[model samples]
Target: MRFPCPDLDPPYYAVIFTSRRTPGDGGYDAMGERMEALAREQPGYLGIESVRAADGHGITVSYWRDLESIRAWRQHEEHRAAQARGRADWYEAYEVRVCRVEREHGFDRQRA
Candidate 1:
């Protein structure tokens, strides 16, 4: 689902992760894809947007239903293992930001 942020309020939590990549890690792409797939299967996963720069900085914004779901995802063993690998090999650095989105509005072109 694609979420277009319009006149949105702030109360819903947003998980924003920004990372800097390491060299020669072809596996990171595959691992990222797998992680995204897995996340969609998890509870409270709303949606995600992933962007990458030519300089190797990447940002992923994942939307969740609540704080508990975010906490659950953070403590998930599989995610923990991947995060460790990211810190050890794939990513040079990362920052996680959690914020609340109070309200949102969007119109689906397809719906019209």
Candidate 2:
């Protein structure tokens, strides 16, 4: 899915990952796709957005059903390994923010 954000209010968790990517590597693309696929298979994974900028900085925000789900994702072995690779190879710098989304709203237009 391109985006996975929802328009509901019942308390959800958001994992905001901001990163500056390293130069010349295909590893990040593979790992990112793997993570997205893996996340969909995990319970409580609502959705995610992987956004990048022209200067190599980007943000990936993933929504979850609860804090427990976020924690489980954090402790996932494959995720941990990917995190390590991110630090060692893919990312020049990165920061993660975990927050509670108490409210949300959005709209979409469809052409007939």
Q: Whole-model Cα lDDT per candidate? A: 0.82, 0.86
Q: How many backbone clashes does candidate 2 have?
A: 0
lDDT, residue 70, model 1: 97
Q: Alpha-carbon error at 57 in model 1, in Å?
A: 0.7
Instruction: Tell me how many clashing residue pairs each candidate has.
Output: 9, 0
Tell me how far the alpha carbon of residue 65 in candidate 2 is from the true structure, in angstroms, after superposition: 0.5
lDDT of 2 by residue, 1-112 (tens): 2564545465888899999999876687888899999998899898888778878999899989998899999999999999999888888899999999887766677522
Residue 77, model 1: lDDT of: 88
Which 10-residue span in candidate 1 carries the lowest summed lDDT? 1-10
Candidate that would win on lDDT: 2
Off by over 4 Å in 1: 1-11, 105-112
Tens-place lDDT digits, model 1, residues 1-112: 2334333234667899998888776688788888889888889887787888888898888888799999999998888999988988988889999988887666788777
